[model samples]
Target: MDITEFEDLIDRLGEDLSLWPEDRRSSAEELLGHSADARALLESAHALRNALATPPVRAPAGLADRIVAAAKRRADPAEPHAEGETAGN
Candidate 1:
C-alpha cells in the first residue's frame, strides 16, 4: 500500500498490526521496518489511540450550560448587549 493508504488503514483499524488483515500485515511490516516515516506515523497513531483511551477529565457541573449560553449568544445576531455596552462601542 502507498503511504496514504497505509496511514488510512492504521487510522481506521487502529494501532494494532495484529488486527490488520492477514494479507496486508506482511507488507505493512516490511514498510514499517524500512521506512522511517512510516514507523513515525505508526508511533504517532499509537500515541493518539492511547490519548483517546485515557479517562476524560470532568468539567465543573455548570460548565455545559455556560458554554451553550455563550454559543447561543454568538449565534443570535439580535442578542442584546449587556448593560453599559453600546452598539458600536
Candidate 2:
C-alpha cells in the first residue's frame, strides 16, 4: 500500500497491526519495511495511541462551574455586565 493508504488504514484500524485483516497487515508490513516515512507514521500513531490511553489530568476544583457561569452570562442577553464592559466586550 502507498503512504496515503497506510495513513488511512492507521486512522481506520488504529495503531494495532495485529488486529488488521491478514491481507492488509502483510501489505502494510511490506510498505513499512521499505519506507522510512511509513515507519515514522506508524511510530507516531503508536505514540498517539499510548498518549490517549493515559489517564487525563484532573482539572482544578470549581473550573467547570466557572466556565458554565461565564457561558451562561454570555448567552443571556438580559444579563448585566460590569461597569466598563458590554455584552460581548
Q: Using lDDT as the measure, which candidate wins?
A: 2
- Looking at model 2, the pairs that clash are none
Candidate 2 residue-wise lDDT, 1-89, digit = tens: 99999999999998799999999999999999999999999999999989999999999999999788778878887988657767866
| Span of 10 residues, lowest total lDDT, candidate 1 | 80-89
Cα error of candidate 1 at position 28, Å: 0.3
lDDT of each: 0.83, 0.92
TM-score (C-alpha) between model 1 and the true structure: 0.63
Error of 1 at 63 (Å): 7.2
**What are the RMSDs of all candidates, in order?**
5.7, 5.2
Per-residue lDDT tens digits of candidate 1, residues 1-89? 66887898897887799998987888889888788889999999989989999999999999999788767766775888656754553
